[model samples]
Target: MKITLIIPTYNAGSLWPNVLDAIKQQTIYPDKLIVIDSGSKDETVPLASDLKNISIFNIDSKDFNHGGTRNLAVAKTLDADVIIFLTQDAILADSDAIKNLVYYFSDPLIAAVCGRQLPHKDAN
Candidate 1:
């Protein structure tokens, strides 16, 4: 099954690296990694360009709203079977996280599933 992971970012330099690294570490990488930036005034775009296997989109609007940016990103990937939305600050642990999420979709009745976020030991 094809899955698209959408990560909406805005001046997310402080956390974007961790999120990208986490995605790279995933055992079951997303078919497509969409990084939607809302005119970030940092090196976020450059950093995203350095990553392999990622699709980056820059929203050039002067006005920025989180939901609007996400909606735009979602519109860009309407063909995907599943859309996994993650924030720029989110760090995915366990390489199999994506795999696990996809596994749950095996049940026809399950529309969506979300996992809990626990503080990383290093974050303490």
Candidate 2:
């Protein structure tokens, strides 16, 4: 199955690199990664650009809309069997995270899957 992963990013802050690194280490890497960046003044665009099989689309920060960006990604990955949307700050817990998630699709009746999130150790 063809899998596409999309992320909407702005500045993404200090944890952005870690998030991208985790994605790179995934056991089941996405066939295509679409990064929609809203005019960031920081290193977001440059860092994402260096990755292979990634398509970066730039937009003015003021024009960003949560639903619209995802719709655009859906259109761009029309041929993909699965499309995964992820926040720029989300880091996968393990290399098999995507593999485990995609495994559910073996059951043809499964329409969607949601990943569980855990609080950071520093969170109150």
Candidate 3:
């Protein structure tokens, strides 16, 4: 099954590096990675370009909305069998996260699945 992982960002400078790293470490790598940046003024574009298996899109609009960027990213990959939406600030707890996500599709009836999110200790 082909899966597309979409990550939407806005001025996500240093945070994107970790997200891409986490994707690389996944036991089951996605078929494609789509990153949509909503007019970032930082180094996010260059950093995204350096990552393997990633397709980056830089939207020029001055108004930034996470949901809109996410929709655009999803539209770019409508052909994929499964879509995985991830935030740039998230880091998978395990390399098997993607593998586990894919396992749900084996049942055939399962249409979608979601992962859990936890606050970083440093956020406190």
Q: What is the lDDT, from 0 to 100, of the residue 15 in candidate 1?
A: 69
Cα lDDT tens digits, model 3, 14-113, are: 5667877788899889889888887778877788787667898878767558777777788888889999988778888789999988899888899989
- What are the per-residue Cα lDDT tens digits for candidate 1 across 1-124? 8799988778886767887788888887778878888788997878877666678988775755778888888898888888899877778877888888888898999999897677655563
TM-score of each: 0.86, 0.94, 0.88
For candidate 2, the per-residue lDDT at 50 reads: 74
Q: Which stretches of candidate 1 lie over 4 Å from their true place?
A: 120-124
Show pairs that collide, candidate 3.
none
- Sorted on TM-score, best first, the list reads 2, 3, 1
Question: In candidate 2, what are the lDDT values of residues 33-94, reduced to their tens digit?
Answer: 99999998899888888776899988888889999988977888899988888888888889
Which runs of model 2 end up more than 4 angstroms from their true locations? 121-124
**All models, RMSD in angstroms:** 2.2, 1.4, 1.7
Q: Rate the local accuracy (lDDT) of all candidates.
A: 0.81, 0.88, 0.82
Kindly provide the TM-score of model 1 when superposed on the true structure, using C-alpha atoms: 0.86
Clashes of each: 1, 0, 0
lDDT of 1: 0.81
